[model samples]
Target: MTAMASVISKITAKNQVTVPKQVRQALGLKEHDQLRWIAKDDGSIEVKKANNNDFWGVVMEQQRRYGSINTPEPAWGPDVGGEVID
Candidate 1:
């Protein structure tokens, strides 16, 4: 695997870390974006950008899984707030 450049960040007293500018730029991060943290068996950790109910992302995933062209209904369940499209 190719080596990626690393940046250092200090954890705040409240256990928060400011994602460095370079990392944020490379990851295309934005304010209010969520991150998913993964822990590997080798005792190392990884951070990945988490999707925030991205519409196109859900569409593509459904197409790949169901092989259907139709937009998949959101599984927001029976009592959710979104309106019915039809």
Candidate 2:
């Protein structure tokens, strides 16, 4: 279920606007927070709270730069060894 919050704000000249209180609280946003936006083919817009410090985007970039780490399992050291035969 989704909780509906009512917020009212106006768009500035450069399409910049402040997020209202109820909306911000609902989204758990704070000052100097970051938001990710994607414009869909349709006029309708879908928005969701982005991960902390843009982790998703950074992970993708890291993968592209430093390939994937899918190496085979490494051998364990002296498994099933008898109690130190000192």
Candidate 3:
């Protein structure tokens, strides 16, 4: 993980790609671990380990900074129509 590494994994007919063992070890990933895929403008993909606590922390930070409205649960409100395109 310290040094740069590259790995390849084939997409199955079901569109599922098995995480390469080396990459899994580098990411400290285990079975059932959630992953987040980010598509960059440069046509490359970034994979990250998804942690619920990290996600909630981000929402809490956003609420703290932007000030949440009075509701049973904090809501960010209406979507402004930003959409992702391939």
lDDT of each: 0.83, 0.75, 0.83
- Per-model TM-score, in order, reads 0.56, 0.51, 0.58
Residues 22-71 of candidate 3: C-alpha lDDT, one tens digit per residue: 87888889989978798999999988887757878678867999998566
Q: Report the candidate with higher lDDT, 2 versus 3.
A: 3
What tens digits encode model 1's per-residue C-alpha lDDT throughout 1-86? 24568789999999999999887777789999888788999999988887868899778878999898768787875775768798
lDDT of 2 by residue, 1-86 (tens): 26775557899999998877777777788887766676799876665676767787878868899987678889886778668775
Query: Which regions of candidate 2 fall more than 4 Å away from where they truly are?
Result: 54-56, 59-86
Q: In angstroms, give how far residue 8 of model 3 lies from its true place.
A: 1.4
Each prediction's RMSD over C-alphas, in Å, is 10.7, 7.9, 15.2
Better of 1 and 2 by TM-score: 1
Sort by TM-score, top down from the best? 3, 1, 2
